[model samples]
Target: MIRAALTSNVQVKVLPGPSAVTTALLLSGLPTDRFCFEGFPPRTKGARSNWFKDLATEERTIIFFEAPHRITESLEDAQTAFGSDRDAAVCREMSKHYEEVVRGSISELIDWAKSKDILGEITVVVEGFNPGTRQFSVEDLVKLVIKQEEAGESRKEAIAQVAKANKVSKRVVFDAMVAHKSGDKI
Candidate 1:
């Protein structure tokens, strides 16, 4: 669609404007060298959660677009996938008369969203994965699965949860579990 729009004979002069994502990125003072733009999140809860899980360990700053009606739910899902304390910025009505930018942890953003009537084009900028935190190994993943199972999750559900939380494949977690059970080094 963008290609077609630019190729049309109408002689279009494209000029840059203060989009919410760009403005938010500039305001956040995060590393600008490496960044990613994830246009719009999936509409469904399951799909969206899965997508967020996939991106949970992204090292580059991430940007996303959201509608007013779904912003609350999206924030909730983000809080689950990215954790409640992950840093994020919510930019609403960018460059408009009522432009607002709210920055804080995911949990704080969720609370703010709940207390207001959020109307406008919303853009969310989330801090990328920090590798300095505790890194999970295959053995760690196995232990996590075991803990989830002990906490009442089924074997399959535990594997899935561990895989998603570690940003790895379910097959990886399953293979790790099998290897651990067989007393083999993982």
Candidate 2:
């Protein structure tokens, strides 16, 4: 094999333009201060389903790039994982002449995706997990920790994950863990 080293001293710069990720996030009407960009979901159905499940506890808003053809399937899985009423937005062909945006609950988006033959670049924005929007009891929180632990996470890691996901303090999760283990009221 012949080895050749090539280097170029070139500085190239251009005006930053709007990207599909940020633009869709902004169009979603969700919080932008803390957000995460998930470039694209898994192509296979099983992997994509698991991927969505893993993001169930994410506290930051999520942005996903999706193809128009798979939008309906992805939306279905999203609805199953994030629940029917989770706030989300579907942006199609953003910034183009035929650009369209639909913002609503996951259920509504699912309906929209299934209603017609979608064509164009698609971006999906989902609101972050908000504990306030849904109530969880001590038992529920404890159960979540246990589930996380069962999913190959350490006890401590599971507790922390549960705390963050539920928007509760570590102490709360620890107390719940102790109460649960000792069969005492929390």
Candidate 3:
């Protein structure tokens, strides 16, 4: 039946897990210049948590592929790792028989995911954290400043460079690096 339907309509779009995510991301009006497509993380709790932890500092939109059986757990993991307030979209069985789209904060999505018997492939699109508001560790700030300086930039110039590269405030970088060098916390 599925193959027959495909044969009848060449223009028909089969929005599977990843493709549905791509489409949703494209329509999100978010920056598409750079993005990461993360298919399903490990099914087990430990590995999955670790996997999500790795993505905590990612600065680009992320896509996930999940099975219906695990949508609730996945959403829960996303909330725990990325924070409950993080904005995201959950697309399930897209372009197919049981298509559904859910969008909201990670916490809300986790609640929604738990209340139903989700069917088919699931695609999740999550917003990246705003770089300006994020507080990097002093060590990291120092490293960034040093990297820019090594690129032939002065302290002032390096602070500016780090700020612009990370979309944060120049003062933030400067203060962090200065505090690090002085053994003080900003």
Candidate 4:
């Protein structure tokens, strides 16, 4: 019946699936230079929210695969956890049929999704932290470590936070801090 309608010149469209989503993600200006796709965070309210929270500060761009039925809810959850103003994109039914891409702040997309009953697969592209937005510097790290030492984080614990946040090795952070104090190049 559907094919017969199309044979009579009826218009039809196809939606792209995971493959198109992946390719679009690869091309998205975010930072596929290095990134990861955590397809669909948990569906449960509590677990899903926590997962979003965990990824809130991730410096790398993230691509998510979402079902149409859940897209609005997922976008809302992402806005709440990653900050409403967070940069993001939603591409649905990519290459084949009924393709649509909405790129904007998380809140903007959330509002857009809520206004319509979405259909087809969706891939969300979100911008990562802009370069040089990091609040801490080498000096700041040292100062924080000093404070942590006084409060309770072992030298090791303080160093770990520095490494985790900076995406460097603990030894690198330690050596740099020590060299800075001693007036030597690290």
The most accurate candidate by TM-score is 2
Between which residue pairs do clashes occur in model 4? 14-96, 14-97, 15-97, 16-93
Model 1 lDDT tens row, 15-97: 32646567666644455567899989999998898688778888899999999999999999988767788888787776667
- Model with the higher lDDT, candidate 1 or 2: 2
Worst 10 residues of 2 by lDDT: 1-10
Arrange candidates, best lDDT first: 2, 1, 3, 4
lDDT, residue 84, model 2: 84
Worst 10 residues of 4 by lDDT: 9-18
- Candidate 4 total steric clashes: 4
Enumerate clash totals for all models, in the order shown.
Answer: 0, 0, 0, 4
Candidate 2 deviant stretches above 4 angstroms: 1-16, 136-186
Better of 1 and 3 by TM-score: 1
- lDDT, residue 23, model 2: 75
Best-to-worst order by TM-score is 2, 1, 3, 4
Better of 2 and 3 by lDDT: 2
The 0-to-1 C-alpha lDDT of every candidate, in the order given, reads: 0.79, 0.81, 0.73, 0.70
Candidate 1 C-alpha error for residue 133, in Å: 1.7
Q: Supply candidate 2's per-residue lDDT for 91.
A: 83
Tens digits of per-residue lDDT, candidate 4, 1-186, equal 433544465543433345755565643434566666888878887777767856766878888888888888888888765667777878776774466767678899988998999888778888775535544456656865675577688888978875775556687779767877897764
Question: Estimated TM-score per prediction?
Answer: 0.67, 0.67, 0.60, 0.60
Sequence-dependent TM-score of model 2? 0.67
